[model samples]
Target: MKYYPQLTKRQAVSALEEFLAERAPALERFRQALRADGRDPDTLLDGTTQGLVPLWGWVLSGLTGPDAPACTDPATVPHEDWPSWERFTAETEAILSYESVQLLDGFISYLVRVVEDRTPTAQWQIGQHPNKRYQFRNHPVLAGADRQIFFPGPVASSAREVVRGRRAPANDEMAGYAQAVIEALSAEETRHEPPEPLVEVEDLGDHPIRGREIEVSLREDIAHEYSRQVDHMVKTLAMEDGITRVIREDREVLLVATPSWNTTQLQEWVTQALRDAGNDHS
Candidate 1:
């Protein structure tokens, strides 16, 4: 891990400029990794934007690991309380594929270090805004009986043909059809459309890039209006565009599945993640 010295408030403007100058390569890499193509982190601190969160804090947080004081016990016990930086990064692969739990824990731990050291949180931030590129895994095309059939996108005809087959009741009939539909939609295609953000992040000052974990847990009472709500939302977004999930009920069980989503338990979490990300910064 690269060590980044913290910038003090008392530092001269030249010092600040020099500080950024020294870190340009590292920060620019972060910008690419974050897809933060809009503004330089804190380079516009002069007046381009006021109280705009400096992105440096996020960078430090990314490089640092969880501090031991963050644990329930005050006494640190090496790996038990805190893992080494090498150990931390080795398992995490933070930039590419760190899981959500690792991110949350690491972030909170970094906060613990900041608070323990009496460091100002604002120093960590530089000027920058997020520009996330949402790439959903699969496109959805809803084909329901007695409902307005939605067949959109390049592979729409193929998926439509699969749905047109008899809704025969055999063992795993729904599962079979779901797989067929998935296969049909899996046809290779390219699109440049970006999904609209459901939750807006406006002038995130001294907070976070992801203001909150945008996740949706299906209401336990989905049998009520929630299922209808889900169906409606899915149908509305199922037209010829960059759709990545198709909603189909088991005719037998609409919102019933164990250990996974959909009747065949085929739908992946990306569908819900994409929806939640677009829905809110919540």
Candidate 2:
């Protein structure tokens, strides 16, 4: 391979601006869909991590340059000629899913080693679903028949928790942590490795759905909420998966390593108190 002259930082920046310009209309369409759905812009659950917007802004501006529409007015761009919203959304989800898997793979490998004596090993293959969900499955660290770890939430939440030693907030507290993670990652010179290019799978004529179909199901309300989450899971997959893995691994590590009888005794009493409360309520 012949070496080409490296572009200066300024030239690279100029090229990025042009790219964002072309995607301006697509971004506007996304913003409109969010507004039409009455979604809160501040909701971290939506995959809008702290520095994500700024980063996207940088991306758009860098790619599209001055030719791109003003960032303030997503409405200025018309949606008539825009791509199908569903397709755009699916692609966005695919991008999220693809990135999440790689991050989870590296982060979990390091974390599990930190908490356990065994060396990390290859356990899962990363892949994307048609719905654009990502997974790192078939890992021994997960302790299952398949030993898989699935990340089904937003990348920001997962990244923040892993890099910052925190978990996603249930309410309003520590809301900025997600943003902090994005900013921190954005400031870093090295970018996370991009996922391998997506591959197309062909449907075979003999293929059939083979899983056992269960007659029983959850109540209507429960099912509806579950469906809603499934519909929106591209946003929350990473964080949810990471938090779960950390808690389980942390508990196991603590049990094995914490040798203080006094501390264990106090924890046992606390556990008994909580169990007693549960029994009394029942």
My TM-score estimates for the predictions, one after another, are 0.14, 0.18
**RMSD (CA, angstroms), candidate 2:** 24.3
Q: Tens digits of per-residue lDDT for model 1 on 47-121?
A: 211111233223222332223233222122233232222122233222211221222233223222222233222
Predicted candidate 2 versus true structure: per-residue lDDT over 172-282, tens digit per residue = 222343333323333423534343221111111121342211111112332243344322321332243221211111111111111122333423432343334342211
Question: Model 2 segments beyond 4 Å from truth?
Answer: 1-11, 19-26, 35-177, 182-282
Model 1 scores worst on lDDT over the 10 consecutive residues at 134-143
- Against the true structure, whose lDDT is highest? 1
Alpha carbon deviation, residue 215, candidate 1 (Å): 50
Off by over 4 Å in 1: 1-24, 32-36, 40-282
- The TM-score obtained by model 2 is 0.18
